[model samples]
Target chain A: MAADWIVFWVCAPISIGSAIAMLLQRNAVHAALFLIVNLFTVAVLYLVLGAPFLFAVQIIVYAGAIMVLFLFVIMLLGVDREERLVERLRGQRTAAILLGLGVVGEVVFAIRAGVGFSTRAPAGFGAANGGGNPQALGRLLFRAYFLPFEVTSILLMVAAVAAMVLARRRERPVASAERRAQEPIEPSEPSEPSEPREEEPVG
Target chain B: MLGQFLSHPPVELGPIGPELVLAGAGVLVLLGGALVRRRQPRALLLASLAGLTGAAVVSVSLWRWRGHATVLGGMVQADRFAVVARLILLGVAALALVLGHHYFERLGEERPEFYPLVLFTTLGMTLITAAADLILVFLALEILSLSLYVLTALSRRLAAVEGSMKYFLLGAFSSAFFLYGVAMAYGATGSTHLSTIARSLAGQTGNQALALAAVALLVIGFGFKVAAVPFHMWTPDVYQGAPTAVTAYMSAATKVAAFAAFLRVLMTSFQPLTWDWTPIVWGLAVATMIVGSVLAIAQTDIKRMLAYSSIAHAGFVLVGVSAATQEGIQSALFYLLAYAATILGAFGVVMLASGRGEEHTSLGSYAGLCRRSPLLAGLMSLFLLSMAGIPPTAGFIAKVNVFRAAVDAGHWGVALVGVLASVVAAFFYIRVMVLMYMQEPLEDVEPDPSIVPRLAVAVPALLTLLFGVFPGLVLGLLERASVLRW
Candidate 1:
């Protein structure tokens, strides 16, 4: 009850506030720090759910490992120097507008359908198809779905490491474009600085 | 079937030995890299190599296993076919590790995560070959792709990021298609397990239209992965943009794994739907081969050229698949093994010859490569020749095997088209050879003096020639493994 109360009162507003602040912060370092606070609140929320393993993992993996990576990436890429807000992905606005339109269209379809989801299974598909989501998922998730379950764990591990690799390279002694860009340029295929700042519009 | 599955052991550990070993190894590498005060990332690389070798050994030991063909509640196929595919994937991963190690060490970088990412990718690819359930197949695909997308961007070049973005977006779209197909399949057959689906298909139960829709969508998903044309808009850019090591590794491994799943899903679950899907494969094969070769000839970037060449190669493999015969599977296996070796070595040379920052990958830069470093040029020549399907090289025999399989299955038109495409491909391969020997060397470009990468490249180069000269070396084993037991 104490944990629940603290989560609702202390962590809730703080988490929401930090998330908003994280989005607004111009400085990458400050933004990253705000994210860490938000992550901590998420771990507390997980603790309140009685998922101790998930709570520990949320803190250690997200707040500890991933946040450190964010900071390192921010510091190493000198992104903090580019304090001016520049949309890294140029077409994001267009993408968002299109996505918004799709959502509106979905809402219209849902209205026409009377019910968004069918309570009764489609004809000839019933308990034969494992009637409900949770029932089927529970059957598959723990028991006979051994390969997929184990594979998912490995998939998560790979995804985490890959995220690190994609975002977390230090400024080189390593063979990177930043160092390559410093050297005399090649006539063709100039390796750019690879930072997510104002990119030229090309597919 | 459900009763039988339940009657067996709930979690059979014996059939999943390689996966268990791979999981342990992946964790070991991940944890070792994290905990140890790192010296050379070479130790991590060595650890990964040991893990891959152990997995391969376990797979080999399982060859011709006498017990049940399905294990883990029929979620995985415990067959020689899976064993062979797993072995090939494991071997290529080991080579890719060495190449990755050399690529980084030469650059004076110590990325402890690289080896783990590679190990995990291998784990995914091997799992894909054995996965007998649609859910497992999708999971394995995601695992390999997520790792690959990250690995592509690991070089952190602007081009690398761009390529990663294209790959990630398109890959997500494909994954959705695949998942939707799985849903459709469940609707049609009331199960996501391949064996149950097969039984449903054979019995002509469940909705036929829904089942057909599932097949088409699943094909589109696998087609994207294998870089089959019409769905292959990302190939050239991603190939040219990714770090050469990633391109080299995934160009070979991804095709093999995707095609393995493709063949298994089609032959196992949709065998009764044979008449429905072969024409689709026929169209894909024709379009992929023709477009892949024709577009490749117009490429200037070496990586992009190799990209299209790989696309053409996929068509050749699909020709085998289109045959819908056991011989076709055998030939496809042989084709994958040879292509893996040839592409790994070709890209290894590109990695070595890319000068200091690994930037000199253009075809023009490769001019006078022979004069500057004869060893790299020779290795490059051997690999290119193999890729061109030239005689006395592995590619020649692989092409012959697949084309012959197509012909035997009465796919004469596809077999003929494949031959024509191979001929067109040879022009570009020889064009590279001509550039290396006939043209003057670029003064600014300097190949790295990395001995280990050179050795790694040499190993595959030797194998390429050996397999070429004697097709029986690996083909003998493949012949035994092609008999799918599901």
Candidate 2:
């Protein structure tokens, strides 16, 4: 019990602090790094809660893969450039701060009131009931939750098709031919050097 | 140890046959589009129609075979209500496809993926109506919403992108709220299945506040989807900005599916708390009716006007929901069918009247439409009359049934508000007709050259008249099918 308290105290502050830092960071990459730190600390907190499988998943999925993807998007879009802090809507910042404070107040109230809340697990749930075991989790997922699991795959497939449809580049045939005829004088342009090189051999 | 828990549970596919058929067809159509060198809009449209027809047949057969049974380990329920909702969804999907074909071709942006996306959305709607678990409901909602977000921006115009962005942000926020509500409900009741949640919640008063909070969040989530008041800011913009066919589909099918799921969830898992939630819905219904009707009268864009009109209709449906009776549920179902047919035809006329590039959706452009094409003007008038709740129209019958349900439940105030809203709504509906018939043509615009869009409008117009004249045909069927047995 003493060690559990020690681990919780150590991890909780780091998690909360990193989350705040993530919001305060100006650079997208820095914010993403802070997010990774927060996610990692949360994974450690999950470990302290005796759910080793959940801890591992939190690290592998959220801290590792998802954060990496976030970083990649940040770099690919060059969003690391400092964004203008100009307020687009009047009193937007004030409204946001008020809402943020309300959320904080709600969280504090929930924590303070939680001492009286019941902690007893529901029927057929707990560590002894294989809640911490990946094998048991997998079995339950495949058996009872099979329909939703399959539907998720369909959802991902739909997302992929939608993304391709939205982002795929359309080839303008007549314009492309006109551009090719005029490309010789602009071969040294840095933005599209490879495009002209690829057409040179074909031409 | 592994072998002990590895036994496979018996899985039944009959209850979910409609969803399966749609998913399979969607994937197949997607692959076919990729493999084909040229855009095959005709073939893909035919394929989508076939899939919808097949799904409808399966849904009807399932209704006949089992009537009501919890299938897939209580993840989904196969009931008469779900079956009827699926049939209505399939009808809307078919009409949207027919209309979309000509609309896309006219815009010169006919893509094969469009039909498959429609199929996937229909699949999501079917699953939503049948979902027995909160998790399944969320997944199905995401699937439906993701497809719709993409479809909304398919036009690739500035307004389309803006609309899609707004919709996507608000939809994601609502989904978060919904998931949080599910978590709270699960925490309070220790289960996500509707029947199990209800059973566990019965006579339990310890976590009443938490449960009430969950109910409020869930209501807010669904309110966003159905365009209830205060959560309806995105509706007019999204509706006016999305392609006409998509707007038509989203207006009709999304409302039907979301309301079906909302009714099922509340009627099953939250039925015991009716006294607590009815007043909330009552407030929403009154606000939505007044706001929707009054704001609609101020719109110049035809699409925006219809968007507000749909919001008012949503209010009427919520009145039935607030009634919380078997008769109320039946009337809501009848109203959905009638509204879907009438609105699809109305939007089809809007799409046709707007010439190429969708440049003529303003109210003034509709002037002198009677002289340009009497057939088109006549069809538009029929739809507008139905929308205004005039005699011998489906909307009138739908309005009467829902208001009667509210009155039966002793909510006379709500019923009165609904009648007043309808009277105000009639002004806008009539304003459109006067613009079409009484005024002279602003420009000598040629009628749509395509026959498919004309047929699309004609079919739904005919159905509206048929249902209006013979309300019993749908009402009787709904009366038998509306009881959602868990």
Candidate 3:
């Protein structure tokens, strides 16, 4: 139990600090590396919480694959220019601080409440996890949650189609006159490396 | 062991027949696009229409289930609530597809994926309506949003790219909030099924603080999707930048899907916490109405103005939700259908009005639309009049239905605010009508005479008047569907 507290105390600050550093870093690559560090700490926390599958996923998928993609995008887009950090929108900083403080206050209230999950017998994680966590997960996924598992394939297919559309070359057989009239960025876009469009952070 | 896991809970196919039909059709369109590369777009359009009609028929057929609330191991629901919402989503998706088909076809481009993606989005919308579990709900949401992000970016124009990017980012953030709420909910109740959550809450065995936090986060997530105030910063830009067809589809269909899920989740899983959540929804409703209407009056772009107007309509639906009664649920259903038909038709006209790369969506461009194309001009006025809640149109009855429900639920104060907001919303809607009818032509650019898209849009315009004049046509069924239970 004390080891649990020690693990939480040690991992919590590092995770949070890396997250803050990730936010403050101007160099995109460094920011991504910082995010990896934060994810590693989260994995450590997950490990201590007795969820090895999640810890593995956290490290392999997020910290490994996603960070690689982030860095690849950063390099390709040439957004590594070290510029002075400045707020593009006025009051953005103050707004950020105020919002951050509000979030912190909410978390503080939640912590002060100190209300862990209800310890009802059927509700306890350990009860369902007895036949091993992965086995339980497998059973649940196949039996109770079959529909979502199948639907995820559709989501991936849509994303594939989207990628194909965005990566199309200018030499494709679009109407020449309309292409010339409609697209100002068509010529330069063939190289496919503009300032990185907003990339959503994957969970 | 694997066989035991697979066969333990037998899955029901009847409840999800509409979703299956939609999925099969979507995949078929993708294959058709890939295989038959010549003159395929038109054929693809026909196939997609058949898909929608078939799905709607499957959904209608599910009505024989007659009040079955739990199916698929309580992971999916079968009820008139889901059936009606499915029909509405399919209707909107069909309109959006035809409008998009002609919009791109007029540009002389072969966008084969557009039809399939719309079908896919419709599938998601229909699936979410029937999602009885939190996991299924989130999955269905992703299925819809991912395709929508692609559809919004289908044009690959800078503006379209920007809109899709913003939508993708903000939507991902909100989805994370929703997932957190789901986690909290599961932790509190040890169940992801809505009925089980309700039972847990009713039994008072759940952690109150955790449940309350979960409710707040879940509302925030749905609020973003519905474009309620404070979470609606993306609405105007996304709407203005997206192709008019995509905007029309998403604006109408998304509200129906998200609000259906929202009604199901909050009104079911969190039913025991009704008093605790209503005040929050009340606040959201008030803010969404006041801000959405007032800000709409200041927009110059037709799409942006409509964006704000849609935000205001979201507030009206939230009013029904805040009432927290069976009548409230029925009225919200009516309001969603009304808003869907009205907005879909209105944007179809906007599609016609903005011809040639959709460059003519500004208010200045619509100075004399009536003289140039009286059919379009008249249809626009009718749709806008419905939006403004004028009598003899769907919007008026829809508004009255919601307010009456709120009053019945002892939420007369919110109903009163809703009435005033309707008046303010009327101003901007009427402003557009006045511009179309009275003002002189600003630019003599010819609007598209494309009959297919026009014919597609006219169905909704017809529906708007039909439902308004005879509200009883659908109200009787909605009354029964409104009786939501475990």
Residue B251 in model 3: lDDT: 90
Choose the strongest candidate by DockQ.
Answer: 1
Interface RMSD of every predicted model, in angstroms: 2.2, 2.3, 1.7
- lDDT by residue (B1-486, candidate 3, tens digit) is 777554666567789998889889999999899787354788999999999999999999888786446876688889889988998999899888889988888876678889888999999999999898998899899889888888888786789889989999999999999999999999889898999999999999998889999999999989999999989998888888888888989999999999999999999999999999999999999999999999999999899999999999999999999999998999999999999999999889999988876789999898889999999999999999999999899998999999998889898889999999989888988888889889999888799998888998899999999999999999998898876777
For B1-486, candidate 1 gives per-residue lDDT tens digits of: 577435434466767789889889989999998888534587888889999989988898888577778887788889888898898888889888888887776666666778888888888898899988999999999999998888888776789889999999999999999999999999899998888998898898978999999999999999999999989999998989887888889998999999999999999988889899999999999999999999999999899999999999999999999989999999999999999999989988898888755578788998999988999999999999998898899899999999999889888999999999989999999999999999998666778887887888898888898999888877878888887655
Worst 10 residues of 1 chain B by lDDT: B4-13
* lDDT of each residue in A1-203, candidate 2, tens digit only: 89989999999999999999989988888889899989998999878776688999999999889988998888888974778899999999999999999999998898667643455554555654474467677867798899999999999998998898788654323334566677666545654545533332121
Poorest 10 consecutive residues of model 1 chain A by lDDT?
A194-203
**Candidate 2 Cα outliers beyond 4 Å, as residue runs:** A1-49, A78-128, A169-203, B1-3
Ranking by DockQ: 1, 2, 3
Q: For model 2, how does the per-residue alpha-carbon lDDT over B1-486 read when each residue is reduced to its tens digit?
A: 666665676788899999999998898888877787655789889988999999999999987755337878899898889989999999999999988888888777756778999999999999999999999999999999999999998887889989999999999999999999999888888788988877766768427777888899999999999999989999999999999999999999999999999999898898888899999999999999999999999999999999999999999999999999999999899888888988888888889888876688999999989888889999999989988889798888988999999999999999999999999999999998999989988876676867878987898899889989999877887998889765
Whose DockQ is higher: candidate 2's or candidate 3's?
Answer: 2
**Residue B442 lDDT in model 1?**
65
Q: TM-score of the candidate numbered 2? A: 0.86
Q: Which 10 residues in a row give candidate 3 chain B its minimum summed lDDT?
A: B2-11
